[model samples]
Target: MALLSPGRLAALHQMGATETRVLQDKPSDSYERGYAEDVDHIIPSPTLFDSLRDQHLVPDDMPAISQCATHLELLEVFHSLRNRVIQSRYLDNAFNIHPSKRIVYHRKHRRQKKVGKELRDTGFEGRREEKWKYYLNIATARFEQWIQGIDTAMNDLEIPPCGRKVLPPLDVLVVWHAFLLNPADFKEYCLKKRLQHVQKIIFPWREIHEAIDSTTWRFTVPADQAGWILQTTLLEPDLLHTLTEDSHINYLARDLLRNLSESRWYNLAANLRQANDRQSAFMQTIHAAINNQIEHRPLVENVQRQCIFVDKMHAHRWIRSPAVQGTLTRAVDKYENFLELFRLYPNKFLVPTLDVDLVWHTHQCSAELYRGFVVDRVGRFINHEDNISRGTLDTGFTSTEEWYQLRFGEQYQVCLCWYCEAILSAVEEEEVKDGGSWEAVDVEEIVERVGEEVEFCRDLEISRQKGRRLPRWKHGAGV
Candidate 1:
């Protein structure tokens, strides 16, 4: 994308790449009928009108007039045309009585954003996404080959090409056809699937539905009564409607006690109904509380105009301080080079540097010693009373400006370690003070408070660090 300019890209077109050809489409094949047909026929400038022919499908009868400017637009043309045909098919089929089958359509299907992600742990990633991604992989591979072909063709030309080269509309469509011909392109489409039948509503809903369904034998073929229970209590349009599609137990168990006229469901249904009532009432209360107690408006920070906050990317128009992107570009040296230069130097003369690989394995104990040193230094900075004379400091450590000046030189580092410390403090305070309330301390407010504290401490010098260590429970982690 960076290689091609907008002017060059716009000028590019695949002229005379595809010829008007008869599409050899057969009925049984679902994929070959849609975009594949359009590409095979090599129809140009196909509008919405051109798409609908031969029972609302792309027909080969239309003249090859429509053309895509680029391979990318051609791909879009393929999808937009194909989706129109397939989506109509689905919508039309929706009228046909869909049998009582447990179709597992994902409610929140998403792609795992982290590249080379696991096929498992499908909290968001769904089967549909898997199928589409698989198809896209095939298409991308085909497109790469097509681009390679175009490059080869350009090289064959006698007159030397200058700047970005353009491919005509026909070339774009031809590559698109190659993309569609890739077998992975149409694997496992939605319409081809027939979902597995759920044996019974299991667990929570299993016991509930079974208590109604199986108990039909206990009362001399109580079939209509069963239908009534399902339709009214569970809110299914009919008994044939599959409840497993979105199995919400509370909604399914509505009016369960009233429906459970049978003696067997008496005790269990009674207990369940009471719990359900409480849950329903509590849901309403939650909604009401959210409406009254929470501000729905998007929060904008307006007050704090002049910040010298560190941990950069804090851009404000009125801010006095400039943002520093980084302190050290290359802080670590190669182990052999570093050792050759400084290993013979006296302990007092040498500034310490971490040989990380060595610390990770051989000299691991040294890491713990360094960790204790930092922890002690931070502990002292937080505990000193003179540093925090205004409001009561939280129990956990926050980096003050005085701490910064004492440890790292005064203006050398604008330490906003206070933000991290405040976040930890807020979380701890919520767990203790919030009780059942869900409202948490505003993180922005913590930032503002930290700013105020830093403003106070930036000028003043204060003594930090205690002389000795006291006993406390120590926690350790390992790689």
Candidate 2:
């Protein structure tokens, strides 16, 4: 397996698919004849960039795109290219269908029986803490595969260098979605890998949301686009079959899976027969330390960090509990206010409550949707950065809390969990000691401190506000 480069395997895969298609069409009894006819189809298909550009040759022929058309609309219409009409409709849709809303969408009958079965087969069924360990391990492994698969596909296949992107399978998409939430980390990963397809990759958020057939549970795309995906990536299993029958990839490229299994860390984490009690505890602590450093690092180096938090939350039902109804509703309301806050003070470094963050993260899972929704409302792209230090987060959260309340007449620290409560208390105490107030965020200083943190920050032309402090709210006994 090691002898065959990914490119060679890709060529073979293309030939095999071409041969099968020819045989099906020709009803060939002779293998030789079918193989000979397969030569024509094996020629590289036009890249997605070419296909999209060809589709929109006549502007009049293009379909009516969403009013909130931003990059998503541009990619759909001009294969490249926002609006105010989009503000109401797009914002409503973003909040309404954001991924986090699905956390409790059908959890009542799904959790203990269905979800448990899913995790059970993945070797994560166990005590709460222990389950986190196994879920993290499997998630991390899958993320590794995704990164490699994308890199390999881009290098080997004729995927567009900068255009509409091909979607990966759902498991890979989950981790990819999380990774893309941190734009800096995602871009750094691309830059470090020297990946050319970074510009070409665009998630089709609108298409997926609108085109999915509920009865079939299938995302319906043009047959050409589906064929493009089959030709370009290793995501061959039927989407419906994947959803209803098995969430696991039973037919993953054997060599790639073998290499993943051979890695020492993956082997240690996945070996179900090993002494897991102590090992899981040890690995869990190590995972925490690793996450601290890799919070905003490249996916290749930080797959564990990328997957662990998400998988851990899922394992504990934090992201999928039926009790999430009110929380998600509040999240949507708060997310609307959060966007409004940004529109009012576009230059401010306002932090969000956990509820708002949840909604924000969900919106971002679909990159096209997020860009269109945010750009329409805020007049610029808002990158959700999580790589800031604890001190920075505390200060920003505290100041943002006050500013949000002042602007919206609502409390921002809504989560009553012990962890959130403790953090809020500490930030409030620190503010009192310093006699601090909500000051305007230093746009230049922040940009310089975090290089390329916001890809479009410099391009957008941030307006500097006067350093006037907002009215302060006295906490507990006055200092």
Considering every candidate listed, which one attains the maximal TM-score? 2
Which portions of model 1 show Cα errors greater than 4 Å? 1-125, 159-479
Each prediction's RMSD to truth: 34.2, 26.3
**Model 2 alpha-carbon drift over 4 Å, by segment:** 1-165, 187-230, 235-297, 300-303, 306-329, 343-348, 372-376, 415-479
How many residue pairs clash in model 1? 12
* Candidate 1 displacement at residue 137 in angstroms: 2.4
> Distance from true position, residue 301, model 1, in Å?
40
- Across residues 1-479, which tens digit of lDDT does each residue of candidate 2 receive? 22123553344345434543453343333112222223222111112123233322222111112211222212122110001111223222312212221222224554454332222223212122222222233344444444565666777775543333455543344446657778656666667767655434545444443433321224445556556554544343233232123324322212222232232233335542443343333333323323432332343333344443343332222221212333344556678888888888877788877556656765665444466668887888888876567788889888888888998887676543222222233333444655763133332343232222111111111110111211211223111
Q: Per-model C-alpha lDDT, please?
A: 0.24, 0.40
lDDT of 1 at 141: 30
Local accuracy of candidate 1 as per-residue lDDT tens digits, 1-479: 11123332222211101100111111111122222212221111123122222211221221111110111123233343223322332212222212233333333337634333223333322322222222222223323333334334444543112111221122122223332222122111111322111111010111111222110111111345334333222222111112113234334332231222111232343444545543443223222222322221111010011011111211110011111001111111222222222323213122112221121111111122222332443331111111232233331113332332344342211222322222333444554777844356554564344333322221110100111111111123100
Q: What is the lDDT of candidate 2?
A: 0.40
